[model samples]
Target: MNNNSSIDQSYTHLEIKIPLDPSANERLRSAVLSRLHELYGDPLPDAISDRVNAELDIFYNYFYSSLFLTYQKLVNCINGSGLPYYLFSSNGASLICYALGMTLVNPLPAHYRCASCRHTEFSNSADSSDCGLILPEKHCPLCGALMVSDGNDLPIEFFLGLRYDKTPYLALAVPHAMSDDAVSLLERSFSVTRKDPRDYKFPMEEGFIFAYLDIVPTDSDPESEMLWRSSSSAPSASSASLAPYEMTNARVFEYLSRPESFACYLPYRDDVQMIKSLLAADAVSVNNISDLSKICGLINSVNWFGFILPSLKSGAVDYRSTITCREDIFRTLVAHGLDSETSYRVMEMTRKGRAASILADNALRQQLLSHDISEDYLTSLVNIRYLPTRAHALELAMTVYRNASENVQG
Candidate 1:
């Protein structure tokens, strides 16, 4: 028994050294600064540097090193596999991740960036409210090349918290064909075990729990393919041949507004049917990315769809006015003169189904009412059992955008 115990201890204590590169921080800093210079031109703005530095500091200080190492390993394995994948959550909505090439979504405000001269411009008055794809075309002032419109106006707070307090979980969607292989590769690389086949847990120090990767196995083909092929009213064959990046935002929204086309974006068959019903009645409109995102959030939530559908049908509330996502609560309150911390608190409470508790405080309730927040809006918050984040909604919207673009370009 003593010999068996000795053997068990030896096995458990096997030295596994994944050395942390001493220069990693400096390298990351240099790479980020270089990319910013490339994107916004040399003599980088002070605001950009300060923001990036702060984010890096948070990462270096707050985030566990194993998380970064695991992410790098997974990315390297995925790239080697040659299967297409996309970051499917707030991680995708990060500027730092984009700069690091860990994600493709650029989280900058809606703007045009000139590839030739690196000239950038934000022409829209309501920059955060608009999608860059829908913006009017413009040529670079410094160069004749047409400027590229990108960015979802996603704040870094969506990825990190308001105080850079949130610990991130990496989520990625890989083609179903290679998901098993992806999981296996990740497990082998980490030398760690997964209780659930889809979630890979990384070894962390004591008290540093919740470090895991969520691998979502998804169909590789564009969701809109079947709809395009089946619909007689679909765009012309020539128009359908446009590349993903070539398709304009207006065209994408037009396609997404169709019940059949929009239904294709939904994951579950029941959700597809429910959304079809809503779209068929014209109770919902997909005018822009934000609208589409809200719809995504509505369907995924527990009571959000039921709560807003009647109002939408009766024309009492439009999609824009309703609190479809947690971000709406924050944005609305902040816009109506609430302080950032208070707005965030309200958002947090509302999302966690604690709005009743929030209202129970007379001072807080009075403060909300004093800001011209309607009783109806507060009531809607109380009904919310579950709410999606704006980051999540935007990620879904971007997925649909990319899939629509690919479907058309095919």
Candidate 2:
């Protein structure tokens, strides 16, 4: 059976209606066809058309679960015990926008500024149609810089197709530094991965950052019928602040210890050795993950994990299921490699857990006490360990001090 068979089964009962207008469907089909031809050849084959249609159907089918997994990864990277939030964008640099979007998390807005005139605009409009904000026709409002649609033009269409149900969230993915012109920002945003690799320059903000708030509907009707309602319909005073994540990409390092602790990477937990091998292999095509199992089976005498599962052999892992599982597995696996961290504090904390549990004998405590981490430090660390991220640690420490002070005063 597929690795995510258990997860898929639970959500199978919840059916969501996807309202597809014929005009919108046709436009999507045309765009897909054009895109396919651009990538392959002028003459598109019937097989290619069939495959594209199959992919689209799968994309629309598992929207909710995909969104959930995306949100979960962002939350884990940003809120883990040893990690910090800024690390997501600051270290992931501009790449966080793509990673977050690829994982189905809300993407931060990417902006481009005019070089000569310093005219700046959103890369994607909030309207969610094209998913990019372009300069007005050939004119930079600030410097009359002639607009040029170059390679750096944001990958808007790639993001638009991947969006979940429209939710109002603010993503500010500005790099800390940029050339006085828009071209540099574009270059920095979309350069070859090996050339720039996701490095965050000390004085730059050339990437996506996230801040999310609830877009609660005022009307009590079901979510499907609640269209055309303005976000401004609610009173501004009552709006809740969306929490912030520190912007950095170094957060990927925190995940390295995850494999040691959890026995498998959280992003690709099942059949992990194969997942890692696939990730390491550049020749492996992400377009079809089942082929990996097939190849594995062939090499292993044609009796791999799939052969062991009767359900999967009976068509349980259909195209829709594979897409859902593959997107999720790949998203998580990449995320494991993308987040950054200052140190492996969560692992240390887990050691502390084991010490406090059945191993709480005085001999064990004394053994742990021999380390640089003192008993008092360990106590404070344990208390503050529950705090969300490194950024919030200071506030939590202060709160602990204040609470102790108030008790003494009372």
Candidate 3:
């Protein structure tokens, strides 16, 4: 950061107020200096100090204003609501963010130890996504309180470089709440814009950051009608001429671009965004998903999870049901990779109960959690059940089937 603030006659007025708080820059510096000293000893090596200072200056200058405050508010809201939020940006590579609690990923060296000698070593090796606590267990003779990883492999320079500020970071937040209640906290924050279905975008304001609020959908939401109406009203391009994912893509773009989140916008959860991600993915061909038109018709027209059951020969789904599953149609959904519990839920929805009960069954719900199914995915199913909007869910199902096919092919 240039210390010389020569007159900048061309500056815009700052509109948003940054809440009065301790300097994040100072906090980052203090933490970095202490960590460096621990690693390099009292008289820190000059080269390391220079590198650290340069990175911190860039970090402090850029974020200490708009980005920092915007994240602070959103993070605080997520924390207050007892929901999980994550930064999706490579800011994970910065020590300041890890120290500042902006990211859980540790950008530091991997910790290791020698089991025989009881000594400790910190170096990059087999690593986990969780950078801080992950360690390869070994011990050697050296007995220090800790070991530090050599960051040279992927240094701070890789993140800060000559121009880091040009990038805008994105974050995803998922919260658990009733169908009508999920967006209550987000509504409390400063909502800057509301999208319109006709594809409208307002100019971004100064003090605010853009947020794609995936608020829960409720029956009262007038915006919901827009999607159903638009999809039906648009001349469904002849199936032969329709681009893969085009309909789903247009619908999602319309949802986000429209000024809907102002008590009038956003989807029920991040699963919708996940659908967006799946459609945007480059590594996969959705050919199989296209082929399963019969299953898609069954799923979009009849049941959200049910159509895939018969094709899925797993014990969870009844084989007897496969006969009734309509194979003469050329293809059907084969539920794959899902555990017995999810398959069971599909079976239940197909045969006995409502999909909303999938989470209501505490035992099975816990099992799903135990299996580490994403909150976004599970919640999407629950909402789809309540929504009874098979067509919208079908868009997601197509993406899911496509992405799964790619993963298997890979």
Candidate number achieving the greatest TM-score relative to the actual structure: 1
**Model 3 regions more than 4 Å off:** 1-51, 63-66, 85-87, 111-135, 140-162, 173-183, 187-410
Which of the predicted structures, 1 or 3, would earn the higher TM-score when compared with the native?
Answer: 1
Instruction: List CA RMSD, all candidates.
Output: 8.8, 25.0, 22.3
TM-score, predicted candidate 3 vs. hidden true structure? 0.35
Candidate 3 or 2, higher lDDT: 3
Q: Per-residue lDDT tens digits of candidate 3, residues 183-275?
A: 445555655333442222323555433433332222323443343223322333132123232223333332332222211212222233322
Quote each prediction's TM-score: 0.78, 0.20, 0.35
Compute the lDDT of residue 375 as modeled in candidate 1: 92
Report the lDDT of model 2 for residue 368: 42
Candidate 3: count the clashes: 23
Residue lDDT tens for model 1, 23-115: 566766676678888888887555556667667887777643444545556665665554444444566456667676555556666777787
* Tens-digit per-residue lDDT, 1-410, candidate 2: 11122112211111111233334434444544564454334454443444445545543443322332233343342223211111111111111232222221122233343445434444444432211222224466666765432111222222222332223121111111211222232223322121221222222222322223111111112221111111111223111111111111122222221223211211112334433443343223222112322222211111223332333345444322221111222222233442212112222232233223422456544544553335753342333211111111112212112212221212
Whole-model lDDT per candidate: 0.63, 0.26, 0.36
RMSD of 3: 22.3
